[model samples]
Target chain A: MKRLTLALMVLMLSACVSVEYVTPYDPVIDNGIREYKESINTLAKNLGDQAGTEAGTYEANLAHYNALESKIDLLIERANLQSAGRGCRLAEGISAQLAKVAPEPMIQTEEGDSYGCTERLLVLVKDQLDLLQNIHQSADKCNAMASPRGTKISCLRATTSKAAMKITNQSINAVWVVETAKKNGDNG
Target chain B: MSVNFEQVLANILDSAASAFGDGWDSIKTYAPAEFKKISSQIVEIAENVAKYQLNDNEGYSAQTGKLLLQMQRNATEGVLVAVSTLTLIAVQNAINAIFASLRETFNDALGAIL
Candidate 1:
C-alpha cells in the first residue's frame, strides 16, 4: 500500500510537468517564409544590378516593394491567427524557459500579446523589409543627383545591396529553423 | 514484487539530464553561430554606412543617421529572440523526457505490484 501511494504520487507529479513545447507545424508558415526569402533575394539582386539606372529607382520598384510588404503582413497575420489558445500556451512555456536562460531583457512583440515565438519571428522579418525599403528610398534620392562626371551616382551600390540581403536572410532563416523544429515533432 | 521510489526518481533525473544535454547542444550550436552572424552583419551595416558617407559629394546624406541604427537594433533583437526560442525548445524536450521516463517506470512498478 505504501509503494502504491508513492508510485501514484510520482505519476501525478509527472503529469503536472508535462507540457506542449512548440506550436503545431503549419505548412503555410514554412511555405510563406521560403517564398518571402526567395522573392526578397531576387529583388535585391535585381536592384543591385540596375543600380543608378531608371529601372532601379524606388519609384519604379515601389510596386514590388509594396507587394513584398503585403506578403509579410499576411504572414504576420497568419502567425497571429495560429490557434490562439494553443499558441498562448506555447508562449507561456517559452516565457518560463526564457526567464531561466536569458539574462537580457526580453524583446517586445509588435502586439505585446501571448502570440508566441513564431509571430515575433514574422515581426522581425517585417522590420528587415522596412530597413530594405529605407535603404532603397535613400539611394533613389541620392541617385537623383549627378557627380562631377555628369553621370548619376549609384548610391545603392552592389555592396550595399548585398549587405541588406545578408541581414534580411539571417532573420528569415531563423523563422524557418523554428518552424522545421515544430514539423519534426520537437514540440514535446 | 515492489516499486522502488528511489530508483524511479533516479531514472527520472537521468532522463531529464540526458535529454537536456542533447537538446542543449542545439542551443549551444545555434546561439553562438547566430550571434556571430548577427555581429558580422551589424559590422557590415556600419561599414556600408561609412562608405556611403565618404562617397556622398553632398553634405545631406542621412542614410544611417536614424534608419540603419534601428535596423541594427532590430537585427540584434531578432537573433536574441531566436536564441530564446531555441532555449525554450530545449527545456521543453527535457521536461517531456522526464515525464516519459516517469510514466514508463511507474507503469512497470504498478504492473509488478499488482
Candidate 2:
C-alpha cells in the first residue's frame, strides 16, 4: 500500500510538470498582417509601374523590389511564429526587416537624369513608412492582450517600427531636396 | 541668386520645432499626470518633422504643411484621450484653435522664403 501511494504521487507530479503549448489567436493581428501583405503587394506593383524600360534602371529597381518582397515574406513568417506565441522570434524578425529596408543615400549624377524614378521610389518609401506605423499601432493593441513574452515582442515591434518610420522619413526628405534641386537647375 | 534649399529647410524646421515645443509646454501644464508621460513622444514627433528638408515648390510645401497640421491634431487627440476626463470632441474646438495658430505661425515663416 505504501509503494502504491508513492507511485500515484509520482504520477501526479509528472502530470503537473508536463507543459502544453497553445497557440494564441488574435483576430485584429491576423487582419493587420493580411492588410500589411496587401499593402506591400500594392507598393511592389507601383514600383514596377515606375520602373522605366531602361535596362540598367529596370534591373536596379527590380532588385530593390525583390529585396522588399523577400522582407515581406520574412515578416509573414515571423507573424506566423508570433501566432504560435513565439514573440522573441517575431521581434527579431521585425528588427531585421527594419534594418533591411532602411534607405541608402541616392547616388547623385551630374545630369540628374533619373527619369522621375527617384521621386516614385520616395513615394513608395513613404507608403512603407505609413504601413510600419499602422503595424506598430496594431502591435501596441495586441501587447495589451498578450502574454508577457508577447508583450516584449510587441514592444520591440513597436519601437523598431517607429525607428524605421523615422529613418524612412529622413530618406524621403533628403531625396525630395535632391530632386527639387535637380528640377530647379533644369528650369533655370 | 541661387536659393539655398537646405538653409530654408533648416529655418522652417527650427521655427516649427520651437512652435511645437511651446504648444506642448502649454498642454503639459494643463494635462493630467498620465498625459505627461507622452511629452517626450510629442517632442520626438516634432523633431521628426523638423528633420525634413522641404523644397520651395508651392504644391509640395502645401502638402507637407497640411500633413504637419494633421499630425499635430493626432497628437492633440492622443493627449486628450490620455486624461480620460474629456472626450476628443469636447476638446476638439480648443485643440483646433491651437493647431490653427501653430499652422499660421508655420505658414508665415515658410511663406517668406518658400
Q: Residue B14 deviation, candidate 2, in Å?
A: 34
Q: What share of the true interface contacts does each candidate keep?
A: 0.38, 0.00
Instruction: Name the top lDDT candidate.
Output: 1
Against the hidden true structure, what lDDT does model 2 obtain? 0.35
Instruction: Output the lDDT of residue A98, model 1.
Output: 39
Q: List, residue by residue over A1-188, the lDDT tens digit for candidate 2.
A: 75566555444443443121212223443343345445544543443333222321323344544655555455444434443422211112222322332343222223322222232233344445444333332322222233344332111122233434343433333333333433333343
- Root-mean-square deviation of Cα positions for candidate 1 versus the true structure, in angstroms: 12.2
Which segments of candidate 1 are over 4 A away from where they belong? A3-17, A83-106, A109-115, A139-155, A185-188, B1-26, B57-66
lDDT of the structure predicted as candidate 1? 0.65
Per-residue lDDT of A84 in model 2: 42
How many times do residue backbones clash in model 1? 0
Q: In candidate 1, list every pair of residues with a backbone clash.
A: none
| Residue B59 alpha-carbon offset, candidate 2, angstroms | 38
How does each model score on lDDT? 0.65, 0.35
lDDT (Cα, tens digit) per residue for candidate 1, span A58-146: 77888998999999999888887773523322243334433443365354334453337688778889988887787777643435433
Error of 2 at B92 (Å): 50
